[model samples]
Target: MKKILIQQLFITTLMLGLSHNALAEDKKPATDSTPRQSTMIILDGSNSMWGQLQGINKIVTARESLKTLLENAHGNINFGLLTYGNKKKSCNDFTLVSKPEDYDKKKMLRNIRKMNPRGRSPIADALKQAAKNLPAENAHILLVSDGEESCGGDPCAVAKELRQSNPGLQIDVIGFRDEKEAQLECIAENGNGAFVVADNTERLKTLLDGVQAKARTIVNVTGTPVDGNLPGSIEVSIKSTHTGGTPSRANFSIYRPDGSNIASFTSRIQVKEYLEPGEYRVKAQWKGQSYTNKVIVQSGKTSTLRFDASQSGMLRLSSLNSNKEAVKANYSVYLANGDFISRHVHQDNVDLRIPADEYRIKADFDGTIQEKNISIEPNVDNNHVFRFE
Candidate 1:
């Protein structure tokens, strides 16, 4: 009898221990297995933000719209703030007021409201500075500006350089109260982003809402398995055919079967996302070449897509007068078969990426057409100078 009682006590102790461990496991917090996205907002604190629209202060409108965006972005996105021309009249007036932290809405909104626009707009330098604060991949820069670059910096060139160096960084521009600023659009185009204009308070709020919605999509995990591995997913891989490696820069724009955009993200080599089981469209841009394809995803499975960049070379074209000094000229790129590719104006130096082949460039220096034929090799930077007599 004593031996049987001892055995029963041992069994009961073991059962109690197991039940305690099970309870502890159930109380643990759930974790998400997705990479977080980071964004740095470059606010245009230039004097123009203080301008008035319909008796409403532009700065007030910006602050209010940002407040709404921050409120909605709470707990969903990581945000940082960089501002220029807020305190003084110097070209180097930009400051990183807030570093990107996980959903710190209150701190970011406070910094935005305290901005006092009083100085010049060093847009180019500001953009470069903003890029430094972001991650090398899966990051964004939202540039809100009301005027042009007053500090003699080429914002377009800087934007292109930023994208080239950090292939994963996207630069978006919001032209507040100004629509005729072509340079702003150039900044967005070269930075692989969008340009939108807002002239009034209500419009500014609505536009900001749109931007925030896109931001959410960017930061949300797209191609990972869910808790139970029930949702479908897709992974994309980009590489170069010449080196058989990832290209220096590439852009991916994913769309639904109904032609609506799902997400536009940049990656040096690869990206993944989780979604519903369906057919999706993917458009990839690299080295001035674009390729589109379709992908299908099924439940509890991952669909893999691959894109290879063709052997392409870069042509740096410039024009000079009889004095060997740079001058404004119209340039056009054409294939050897006389097929036109594109055109540009007032670009002292333009970089054109073309497949490895023969090409012809025409430069119109104030109506005097100068033509030159050249050959481009794979992964080479070919420079050509058009000297007008």
Candidate 2:
């Protein structure tokens, strides 16, 4: 009887741990392939960019990186440049440096090399003008900054509004130094992009390359009630032939009959919910990211939904030496009960695919033993890397 009780408890914990993800079985969103996307580069010409790093000025690095990016972004990839250095102090000081144009390698390199970093960081104004500046309806903004707004502009507010105005618009931000990461992250999310840190000027090239790669993804969503009734939750199945890398956010636009924006959120690798929907548009936003698809929302039967990166956080572990190397030995992971969650023999990584929760992780490998309690959250990655002899 004691053993039965323990088994029941383990089953209960496992189910409860994954309750959040179970909602995907209820409602499913349609999937559709998307078209090619364009990009807009928002250059932060603040004096900080001109500062020296590793005996190399960042602006110079930015220029070189721009040349490399422009040359390799493929012919379909167009470009645009918005510089804060070229702005004025008056209310009408906002200007458009270069509208969205063909990726002219020569012109882009020249502009970057000629960039004279000056003035305060006017992020808000630059974003506002970016919207007015870019020609394509579906485009992304690459915000390169090292500090907060010196010109007292609310960049996040502007980016959010711009997203509402432009359905597929996104903003990918890279901070050069340890400034306000949280604030800038919001700006990135508002634009439906990702925020990253550039520890050095050299990373500018890699960062932009990643952003460019992420921009090509395009996912389309269409929604309709199930059996003429709306369910408590919606299950969206994502089927795509992706080559490599990950798409940041699932673009969603709740619209009225007249096709005006109502509510929008970037999906976090989970089936989205809270639907009393009429008509909606869900598009994937990333720089070079392209997909040919439609997001169909069905209201009736629960359908399975898949996430590129499961908001569900989990970890795979293996016993390792002090050198942080996996050990070639017998190992097994178990729940509080004796039920085997996973086991290994000389394996480097073990699958710990689970929903967000805290766990007492134990390991026995190579005749050495260790145990650890681990936690996995929904939106953020869990912090747990273990090694054992």
Candidate 3:
């Protein structure tokens, strides 16, 4: 009887031990072998960053915004920094401040603060360089620029190339002003990313936070979220030139085939609306002109409508004296109907990206007034030098 009781107790003890061991094994944490997402921050160090907004220097605002981004970044994402035009005035002026790695707040902040804007904007090349440093196939590039490319590089084309070659890459751009907003839009659109305008510090911080989150919110230049939810979508883009367009400032209205109004909203470069699968008419009002196009939307798919608002060309104007030396002059641009487009003062040279049309240019050099009529053709560069007698 004693042996039987001891044997039964031993069996119970052995079973309990085995069960505990099995439970411990089941509770072990699983390991994740997937790599972290990486993002590269391409800061624009162009001289124009010295420009002020609401009495604060843009560079200062950018620095503060970046600090906020770093402080609030997620641990799963690794960030790298690349800056251009910060060291000196050169087209090739850019540096890889840091490589994509674990977020080092102190080190990153130190490098960001030490940067100063002093050079030209090499946006296209900077995009190329940033693409090369991407450690992982799935990566993001955030380009912060106050101006367009000064190196004569086509950033839009480069962005398209990067996106097409790497299916997982996305590029987002931030522009400070409305000047050349269309070009910035092109970069974002071609790169399969988003563009947001941050003219002030608060907006910059908010925009940076949103970008860091990797949660895509369809926002326009005004920072407003697009409103729509339906079965299908239509994307409308109106451009003055065949190569690039400024749909950001265009007004859009959509209608059904029966002539009933469906939606009306202003475009921020490109506007997309979700609707029931059907045919619709899209009209775009831009530069005091209206253009219309027809598109058919299919369920679970997005249709695109691109309107060629007008052909566009480049106009380069320079002021020179009889001695062939550059002289400061005031110039005003007007349409054929005498509508004023823009005015510049005391600039020896100015480049105008305008729709192909008849234009009247009035130049004043030390009170010597001159008027000229010129026609611009699509994709042509018209260089006109005003020589004062």
Instruction: Give TM per candidate.
Output: 0.49, 0.49, 0.51
Model 3 lDDT at residue 89 = 91
Worst 10 contiguous positions by lDDT, candidate 1: 223-232
Tell how far residue 118 is off in model 3, in angstroms. 1.0
Off by over 4 Å in 1: 1-33, 200-389
Native-referenced Cα lDDT, model 1:
0.72
Badly placed stretches (over 4 Å) of model 3 are 1-32, 200-206, 215-389
Ranking by TM-score: 3, 1, 2
Residue 168's lDDT in candidate 1: 76
lDDT of 3 at 172: 69
After aligning candidate 3 to the native by TM-score, how far in Å is the CA of 32 from where it should be? 5.3
How do the residues 85-131 of candidate 1 rate in per-residue lDDT, one tens digit apiece?
A: 98899998988887665335667787888888889989999988877
TM-score for candidate 3: 0.51
**Alpha-carbon shift of residue 93 in model 3 (angstroms):** 1.5
Q: By TM-score, who's the top model here?
A: 3
